[model samples]
Target: MASSSFHAPTLVSILVLLLGNSRAQLTPDFYEDSCPDLLNIVQAQVEIAVQNEKRMGASLLRLFFHDCFVNGCDGSILLDDTPTLIGEKNAAPNANSVRGFEVIDVIKAAVEEACPGVVSCADILAITAKDSVVQLGGPDWEVKLGRRDAMTASQAAANSSIPPPTSNLDQLISKYAAQGLSAQDMVALSGAHTIGQARCTTFRNHIYQETNIDSFFANTRKPNCPGTPGQGDNNLAPLDIQTPTLFDNSYFVNLVAMKGLLHSDQELFNGGSTDAIVQNYSQNPDAFIQDFITAMIKMGDINPLTGSDGEIRTNCRLVN
Candidate 1:
């Protein structure tokens, strides 16, 4: 792979020639200053783009799932540090299996056409997710700005950070906690799985052996998720029953129904300590959204580099 090499003087020279700011690094403050309406614009633009794709909701839903599950949506999992083709593919394209980067690429193109280099992909994802929640009729979340991009994506981190569909409540909590999120945040963030789709392979164990899921629902799903090994592609799981495109609390409703597509989801209500909260949210969307917003806010703040920990990235795929 080929990369552009940079030295402080050369970068400064170019910046001085272009924007006349030789001393200032590409900063998150730049986005806030140059594009005051960036978040709203990103939100609207993401909605429009997803509407056109017919898969935006699924994509955004997956992005958030992977983001929170992996490195707490810090954009670290998306970095392609070594630039290896396999690394990029595994870390970038396959992280969430929801095709987030593809949507992001489209959004990036649109943003470039509209605002040039003023917006970062990481920020685009943050704002886009907030709007996606609103699009799905969930609570409105306050997303802070100034998230920098990573130059190198971490495939190792991606593997370790993302949550498998079969993870138990305890495993899920531990992973999210590493990102600075709490158990409640994990439960709420997991609510996002309410609006997407999963392969049968992801939750095969739950159906075939887990004692938690309702036998009736498990039997219903068995024909679709047959035990044949490597037949994972044959099975399908929908995240939301009513409006998969809209982010809401129906996932919890499905959990109570024993219709959760993933074992991890079913585990919450099957026989876990959080079952009551899951049932409560399943029964009340309003309360779910209120808590979901709170959880998302917490998830977004996990391990964030501020006050000198991380640099403000000009490009999301690379570190500044």
Candidate 2:
């Protein structure tokens, strides 16, 4: 009689575990009941930030990409270093490159005021990125929510996982493929450069040494990004000179003209496997917008810690 009771309870427990895992899938209305005004709060804050500085829209979008790529959109990139935890902030690709943390803090404060501890920072990032796209004239898509904040951060993973600005075509394809993204997705996502700017140091080698770039474009950027070390390293240059502040197909157009600011940016159009996709995007704005929206949605689905796996962080910069 004792053994029978134990076996029955164990079977029930197994079933519960399976059901719990199945219910961890993300949905657009995940916070509908808990935080009815969640989307409004995020959109209002993001609009104000982007209105103050047009680049803030691009910064927020980049922040989402950095967070998602490093550790599956679990909000690990936002964590600050502690005695036991090394955060992704100081990673090579992100040390001085990533921005918009202050904007996220502002949005989180508004969310906490309304919903207290109900919303997760991961969801905040996903929504803010979507809002940023809309503010910058890009296509809007429903961002699936329910991701939890990571208790730990990985600087090593951030360094290795995130592709560098100097990546070649093959490297870029393989890097995105490792994250389950296709080459077409990579080309579409690269269109995000339409609004952001890169530091001189990031494109110095590309402008100075790469023969794939247009001579005129390379020479124009060289004065600000000198070949000599420590010279104009922090200078800023728009990634897409034609429409630097607008989210458009100009980035692909520039790539076709060999005017891409970074080596990685040019790699998509450099007679490689991604060349056809880049050509298609350059000639068709609607196609680029559709693929970009689909790619962003796919990227957001990367290895999230859902259900009870992680905690809802009260502060975006610190784990609760």
Candidate 3:
């Protein structure tokens, strides 16, 4: 890791410089003049949300990931369905799965108060994601900002673009690669599961039908998630069996032991190209943290609406 000497701040600064001509010319100091207190405002609201529910940290992070994956790092996922506008909220991958929009709304209101209409909900989400990770004991990074909100969100794109829990190794790689992320980035981002919970509907088949899982791990989860389809499908289970509330490399460790809570997770360590990446992350926390931050910044660059392309929405759920 030649880039090990570079800190997250410096890495982000370089990215800002490199992307100056692209649509994602987002800067770490994007709000330095207009909304100097933007970071603090978002962080404070996120701290409050996470205090109420520790799971909110992971939910916020997942919201950012889902938002970025759909079209870009725009605030499309935060949009509410209107009579004419169909947002991504009801997308198959989102619907009842993606949580923390209410938390984002709270943060957006606070941000609007501090900075008025200068900030974008998309940028609020980016900042909140960093704060959420820090709240959950994960490494922090400088967040790139200056993205605009997408007036139109595609439910179809959300359904097709965001990777599903049942995805296999090849599907995972292809899905991420479609978004310009490398296989390494895919495995690194998957490490976020260290903190969140998955629905029984998402993992029922993995525990009951999968042979690669640990017997003990499967049994522990079985009592909670009924074997029959649609039964107890909404029961909650931690993605990381060991540390469900902490952000750490425990997810990769679980995959190595065949205790991954989802089929998509086990696919990473199932003797594929990503197996070595998973092993490296499990053994090297520093490496994992660095890669996760880098991948996050990279993912934030996807198809962003910058400059005169998109408007700064006063309300995240409704376009101005």
Candidate 4:
């Protein structure tokens, strides 16, 4: 969907936040009493989606990352453009990309029926990310819950906060650091790339102009990803060349081989501080999986809106 005009935050939104900034701690069983079926409902829907399309697991996981990075995991990424608020779906990094909203909508419907106003869209995203990873043969962690949906979304934040495919090592480290993630956490979390695909537009320059990439790998990618701007822009290329549908340590192995599909993916091991971490993960799948789980849970803790801060949207697409 095309983005509507951007909207600046209203004065009221600023004041309301200043008045109530105390956050409640998120817990693993936040919905045990109110929504006993919440986890099952989300897991079932996510499993179905991934079963239908293996790539969907990556998309759902990407959605959660995109949401959390911009505005701190408040479900602001799920908001739709209205007469007022500007949604993040059409932001620069997300426009024509960052999908799986329809899947999220379906999950929300099932959850609403089972628990009504108890669960939040923000919490749904956390669980969906975990379930999606599990469906794709990745390690699973107990997703902490009780996040509330944002009343407004920042398209500007979405554009700036999310690290682009072209990001370099330093830029990547700084961006992840800004979100309270250590550089080690950044590399571990990046292992999620093992199960995703990138559009040709995202990797065109990396394959053509970059020297760190392997020659044969770059040559293999060139035919599918034309050098000309806008040509074959949306063409698909697997993030992990060996097994794009599986969530494993192969992504780190690709980095070791200098075959990372995106510039940012290669940055993890490009003679930087994160190189050792990447190397270890490439050799030790157990270490990578454990660290990845640690990073996912850490990322989920970023600036959540708990207690009475935000609302539990009945429809994830629209505020009630």
- Mind sharing the TM-score for model 3? 0.93
Question: Candidate 3: deviation at residue 225, Å?
Answer: 0.3
Clashing pairs in 3: none
Q: Write the residue-wise lDDT of candidate 2 on 89-157 in tens digits.
A: 999999988999999999999999999999999999999999998998888889999898899999999
Q: Compare candidates 2 and 4 on TM-score and give the better one.
A: 2
Model 2 regions more than 4 Å off: 1-14
Worst 10-residue lDDT window for candidate 3 reads 16-25
Q: Backbone clashes per model, in order?
A: 17, 0, 0, 0
lDDT of 3 by residue, 116-224 (tens): 8899999888988989999999998998888988889999999999999999999999999999999999999999999989999999999999899999999999999
Worst 10 residues of 2 by lDDT: 17-26
TM-score of each: 0.78, 0.95, 0.93, 0.93
Q: List, residue by residue over 1-320, the lDDT tens digit for candidate 4.
A: 12332333455677667655534678998899999988999999999999999999999999999999998999999999999888999999999889999999999999989988989999999999999999988888899988998999999999899999989999998999999999999999899999989999999999999899999999999999999988999999999999999888999999999999999998888888899999999999999999999999999999998888889999998888
**Location of the lowest summed lDDT over 10 successive residues in candidate 4:** 1-10
Instruction: In angstroms, give how far residue 154 of model 2 lies from its true place.
Output: 0.3
269 Cα displacement, candidate 1 (Å): 1.5
Candidate 1, which ten residues in sequence have the lowest lDDT sum?
Answer: 20-29
Model 3 whole-model lDDT (C-alpha atoms): 0.91
lDDT accuracy of residue 171 in candidate 1: 89
Comparing candidate 2 with candidate 4, which one achieves the higher lDDT? 2
Local error of candidate 2 at residue 275 (angstroms): 0.5
lDDT tens digits by residue: candidate 1, 114-151: 67665556566777777776665566756765554444
